[model samples]
Target: MKGIIGKKIGMTSVFDPGGKQIACTIIEAGPCVVTQVKTEATDGYNALQIAYGDKKEKHTIAAEKNHFVKANTAAKKFVKEFRNYSEEKNIGDTITVDIFAEGEKVDVVGITKGKGFQGVVKRHGFSGVGEGSHGQHDRQRAPGSIGGSSYPSRVFKGMRMAGRMGTDRVKVKGLKIVKVFADKNYILVSGSVPGHNGSIVLIQK
Candidate 1:
């Protein structure tokens, strides 16, 4: 798969050629410079590490600074690798949003927003035992009757319960490429993708 690193700018609505309004996620992608090219002989794998975004030199670390020096470029805030390509490329090569065209399909991977310590009502979508009309006072939102009185000795292993939620790596597949603005280094993808605005996302074609 051919992959690129992008930042989610925000969501916007654009009119298609047929005058239909399309909801799209705008991503500022690319103008990424290749930092290193790993070969099977040296690294036991083939990959190209691309770097993008300028970072403040005062806040940059020594190791990352060395990476930029090797590529003869400024320090970037993001660096990612794309592996196993059919074609060969060299270091310092730039890959922009121009690689993707309108109406193409791509897969996006990112971390979802965190919703900490959710209940069964929001987490697992449980009905939670309703009102207290049947002499049930405090048990308004409870997963009633987890098991019987004298049946299994313990709860089921894969039973759904309320605990932590969200803040996980998620991938949405087959998102249509609604539009591509190469000059602006932006691409519009249809449907919701994981993560919040300015979050880094991996796009694969």
Candidate 2:
């Protein structure tokens, strides 16, 4: 269970050896510094805390500033804890894009783009009842008939309806690593990842 924090750098198409075009998402991965190491004997579990991206000192609180100072690293914007890392690395160690190799299967976790206040037609894919004919002209995209007539009249819980869409913590599994550009700190993964451009993502293997 080795992973790194990265930024979504957008998507592009790459030509494979078979001359077929493969769509890939570009991510600017690591140079992540280990901020802390938790052991089972002390923290009741084993995990590594890694931090990525540069953050201003003014934006950091006093406790976090002291924590980063103890780790001997500058303030970072994103910090995540990963359990069952492949190797035992000490705090203050740096992990880079070189940790990933081309043609490896990995899982990417990220937040999806937010679509505020969506309708049931677009959000839940509800095909409205009643046709356009017979005086039903304007009810084409409406969510028809929510509750029953008499018994249990209130709307049922967990009913899919119109509301906010996207902006969810989504995990995409089994995405292949198409390329690794360690020199530039960029890695390309096959298929799409969650979130918009410049959003943070976690890649796990």
Candidate 3:
């Protein structure tokens, strides 16, 4: 899979050719630098290690600084390895949003926004325990009857009780590219994507 790193730039609606309004996510796709190239005979796997987003020189360690120096690129904040990337790219090569074309289907990978601690109703879509009327009291949001009494005794594994929510690694596939701005390094894709504004995302084809 060939891909590029990008920053989420929120979403907006655009009019299509037939005057239909389509909601799309705007992303600031890379101009990523090829920091390293792994070969089968050398690293036991084929991959391209790319880097994106600038970082301060003072914040970079000596080893990483030397690595970027060898690639002729500045310190990058986000570094990722793309396995089995088919493009014939070498170290110091620059990849931009031009690699993707309009109307092409791609997959986007990102981290979802965190929702912190939550209950069963909001987390697992469980209907709250009936109503508070008829002496039901505060049991409305409770997770009812988690056990089988003397049969199972204990709560079963994989129960959908609430704990933490969100901040998960998510992949949204089959997203069509609505538009591409190569000069500005932006690509608009149809439909929603994971992550908040300015979060790092991977667009793979």
Candidate 4:
């Protein structure tokens, strides 16, 4: 697998060759530094630990400082490990957006935007109980009956109910790479990515 840590730069529309307007998410990917190179003999697995985004030295701890020092790079805000990396990259090496190309398919992993507390209508797309005419006061967004009267009287586990929503780690797969701008370290993906604008995301192929 080949991967890079990136920041979502928001969305935009571009015109394709056939004159079709394509909506895509702009991501500032890579120019990441490889912090560690784990091998099967030493770490019992092969993975490349890369770091991206600048972080303040004052906020960095002693151990983290030492780790970044070994990579000969400054402290980074995001770090990710890609197992079975296809390329042979050594410690302190740099990975850039050039690893990906236009029309290539990749997967993006990011945290969805936190919607805070939500109801079943927005959370699970549950249509609220009918019209509010028949003595229905706040039943518009209610979850209705939760459980049965008897028998399995308790509410069953994994029941879809209104609660905390979003802010979950989600992986969107098979998203096509619409364009790549190596000069700007940006890649336009052919779909919407998770998280809000400027959020960190991991692009993997």
Give each prediction's root-mean-square deviation over alpha carbons.
2.1, 0.8, 1.1, 1.2
Candidates in order have lDDT scores of 0.88, 0.94, 0.95, 0.95
Model 3 Cα shift for residue 55 (angstroms): 0.7
Any runs in candidate 1 off by more than 4 Å, and if so which? Answer: 145-158
lDDT of 1 by residue, 57-98 (tens): 999999988988988899999888888854566777788897
Tens digits of per-residue lDDT for model 4, 98-191: 9998989999999999998899999999998878898988788888898897868799999999799999999999999999999999999998
Ranking by TM-score: 2, 3, 4, 1
Give the per-residue Cα lDDT of candidate 1 at 21.
Answer: 90
Evaluated with TM-score, which candidate comes out highest? 2
Q: Which candidate, 2 or 3, would have the higher lDDT against the true structure?
A: 3
Per-residue lDDT of model 3, residues 1-205, tens digit only: 8999999999999998899999999999999999999999999999999999999999999999999999999999999999999788999999999899999999999999999999999999888889889989898889887878888788989989989999999999999999999889999999999999999999999
Instruction: Give per-residue CA lDDT, model 2, range 13-55, as digits (tens).
Output: 9999899999999999998999999999999999999999999
Candidate 4 TM-score, true structure as reference = 0.96
lDDT of 3: 0.95
After superposition, the stretches of candidate 3 with alpha carbons farther than 4 Å from their true spots are none
TM-score on alpha carbons, each prediction = 0.89, 0.98, 0.96, 0.96
